[model samples]
Target chain A: MPTSDDKPTPNTDEPVTGAEADKAAEIAAAKAKAAEEVPPKNPWEEKPVAPTHSDAMDDDDVVALEGLVVSADLFTGAVTATVDAEKILDVCRFLKEERGYAFLVDLTAIDWPEREEGRFDLIYWLHRHEDSKRVRLRAILGEDQTIESVESIWGAANWMEREVYDLFGVIFENHPGLERILTWEGFNGHPLRKDFPVEGIDTGAAIYPDVYPPGGGPIVPEEGEGA
Target chain B: MMNGPERPLFDVEEMEISFGPQHPATHGVLRLQMKLDGERIVEAKPIIGYLHRGTEKLFETMTFPACIPHTDRLDYVNAAHNNQGFCITMEKLLGISIPPRAAYLRMILAELQRLASHLVWLATHAVDIGAITPFFYTFRERDEILDLFEEYCGARLTLNTMKIGGLPFELPQGWLDRCAKFVDAFPAHIDEYETLLTTNRIWKRRTIGVGVISPEDAINMGLTGPPLRGSGVEWDIRKVFPYDRYDEVEFDVPIGTNCDTYDRYLVRIEEMRQSIRILRQCLEKLPEGPIMAKAPKVLRSPEGMVYGSVESPKGELGYFIVATEKGTTPYRCRVRPPSFVNLQALPQMVKGSLVADMMAVIGTLDIVLGEIDR
Candidate 1:
């Protein structure tokens, strides 16, 4: 928590002269080496191994878990994983407790719509509070598919799972409440599925009505017309 | 006997009321189905996505450059933050390093954007809690920020200033002076906001100790931004990951222990102060160099993936992009919006509180449903 009180002079006030540049370069080299040696782990408790920082990483976050190509790297003191999910929760919990990446940032699916096996990828971004590291876990599940559920670690995953299920049609097995989140009952398609049409506009999110009044009320209700 | 017999036929003392989709407090077209017992809320359920445009699906059809502006609409209040996140992702995928000046200019724009965004938050939050005059005061400062935006970028609201690599142009002349003045004086204005709300009795009664979340729960639920920091988790991607020149800028990451609505409000106010600090550091240290990255105008990345992010006012705003061998649209583009993740903790935040406090909890969460629904 570096405050103005702590820092008397502004950091940018001094010039980055040749000596300072040399110092920075030297620091960068040493720090980059240290970053590779051991990644940052849980901070509160003592650990046998020293945790390294993922600062100078180049293609380091990606992890190859059992027939899947995914990367798990630390971002902003949080572990953010990039996954091509052939496997989901198995890989996620491994990072969760074993690696201390306890928090589940979010569970989402991105639709490619163009590629074949890579048409849809399920993404899970996890965070560890103790170490304050983030790792992303992903499963490359195509459209019309289901992936593993991680309601075991974070109870908050239930609603997120429901939203993903409702929006992307990527089912999560064993979720306590894996029901539609935003969409109404008997709604046709996974509205967020890439190929799904943005049609049947529920203008004003109006509810469907029964009479000749149509499903909702009039499209525009006006007492009189004026330009 | 008559008094006993005079009891109403039906016990209709309580009623279930749904607010929003039309109400004033919702901000957007959000509906809250609340079960109330005599003006006290018993249960509340947020029926969301009244404004869903399926932007994620739409991104699949559009090219990378075109998607940046659409992001502006996601969390409309923090449009530049959204634009910055996308531009960073695009730049990373192509493996292009932007000029030093562009990064500095970005810091200035982003900090000002933060001020404007917080101004809106202050205005709206106060209005929600019955402070009438603060909105006008905050808006006056907010207009200055918008004027700064108009001076730099042609558009004020949805500023599509960022190009694929760096920026379409450089900062207009005298921009730095104006920004420096703003950063220097912004702290006093923030102090003014605090004077109006922070210690005010009604503000505290309504916010402090209301909708409290513990640090453990906040981390477990994946809450980020001020909400997570309010619970004492010192995690901010700008400081942690250090994308662009965020490493060059020096600032503090503010945290709170109480983890309540008031803690969040305090954390946000402190964060604005810190943003001003970073802006000053960036402006003084800004270098003279090209603004754009030296890459092909019509850019294409080698087939792979890149996830780029910035520490937005809300939280970690990240873009997950997968580029294919074919040099065209991205194979996949996923925006991990902070507001979306922050909203996940809402049900947890409001479970034990009175129904009206649910709005306070949600308001404190500071979610823009567009990002939540996007």
Candidate 2:
């Protein structure tokens, strides 16, 4: 029958009614309780804490290769050692022979075109069967520098070295067959380099060459012109 | 002269042949350049990369979360493992631990995907070895698993169902019951497959003593999954690394002694049974909790690199991510595709065997070209 606005307005000059004052106090108390009950911000809502690289100098494995390893650090509980590009072959041999890291889990390269030290970071992940231990070796190489291949150490490095060469254009000297792998024999450029185009360049191997010109297929009209 | 020797009729010479970039027996665009002494393979060189789409380069351009779908396309048949591998690596880089329920749910989906992948392998491997009936039988069961996947995530083949810290969506109502039912009935189907091929004289004669790789050579070739286990090496990423609550579940790592095509086949069939054991455990112990972890809206990974792997159906599928400080996109994301690495051993396996046995070797490897050429 009545609306909320029909309630009388409290005045500073007039003494407030007891029931109304109690009700007002109760409302204030409920609001305070609600404010207090608000949960802490979830991890997603807060600024995430960035992980820091920790020194792995004290690790036994890193210490085992004291002279060969330039520096060692731990990332996500895995030991990563930076070795000279020239000594990658030696390091791999030592790890495989002496350290019992018989398995070459993976070999890949990361391109850093703008870095002052080198243009690429070559990574080799090795694993040991006993105790299931793993280690990652990082080798820095200049754009024109060639790193010795570890294919002789671990037979598994054959295609992996080729893949690194195919993708990043890193030369693996003495690699049995270092020709392009993922790409054809005469692919113009290494597609994995940061400078390469994401949309892809014209490889001149277009489908239906007679019907559509090289780099041409099913042309679409301009944004507003298309239906 | 004709009675003296048949050798004088013709001069013996080796033949060089290009096997396939299109042939079905090679399985998805793999070409093997072979130097053969008559019908025996003297040397077989695997030439891959027909399906390479520069997926790693694409990962560099996309944000951390955006790369999950791209991983699905790597091993298209085993997309769930690919997604899990990428998500686990990203979580490691981001230092975000997912909720328990999410972990169990991931295990369930991953095991189901494993079963589906093995079924595909068995069907194709059987067909490749000249038994056509297993193809129909295996695919029949595989479709049910795919239907379960479709019910859960709406995509059967390339399921981009996982998220960085957890899952994209919680299970639909009655999804677990359906999955449980499938897991329960899957062993009998496996038995049916074994009855058809395990002891069949043709299958045994074709597979046994064919493509035999010694344990040392298998490890030297960096083989994983059944191929490595087929060589009698008891190694599994789930048991070794224990990602995604694999530590909580109990399952056996099936190994084979002979290291031939038949042993690998037995290893995979036993693996499907072990996957059932894992699925049963997960379905029962799926705890009630959040499906997603407490993560930032815009995921930013710390500077450095991390390699995280999962036991995909083919082998040890890994994602190696190198992130810049607080970078949303990976500086470099290299996928250690199991098929790509395992396919490297094809030449080793096919060598010194008959030309027809090459089919059995390729089949035993269980390599998917999408992952191999990615």
The Cα error of candidate 2 at residue B284, in Å, is 0.7
Residue-wise C-alpha lDDT for candidate 1, range B1-374, written one tens digit per residue:
36555766667676778788786667677787777675566666677777777777677668778888898988888888898899877766665567777888887788889888878887887788778788998999998898888898888888887876667877778987888888788889888888999889999999988778898888777777888899888988887778768998788998988888898898999998888888888988988867776666465555655677888878878887767664667766777778777776776677657766776776787778788777
Candidate 2 docking quality: incorrect, acceptable, medium or high: acceptable
Best by DockQ: 2
- Among all candidates shown, the one with the greatest TM-score: 2
- Stretches off by above 4 angstroms in model 1 are A1-87, A110-120, A129-133, A140-145, A192-194, A197-227, B1-15, B37-40
- On residues B74-145, what C-alpha lDDT tens digit does candidate 2 reach at each position? 998999999999999888888888888999999999999999999999989999989999999999999999
**TM-score of candidate 2 on Cα atoms, chains taken together:** 0.91
Provide i-RMS per model in Å.
12.0, 2.4
lDDT score, candidate 1, position A161: 83
lDDT of 1 at A54: 65
Worst 10 residues of 1 chain B by lDDT: B296-305
How do the predictions measure up, each by TM-score? Answer: 0.79, 0.91
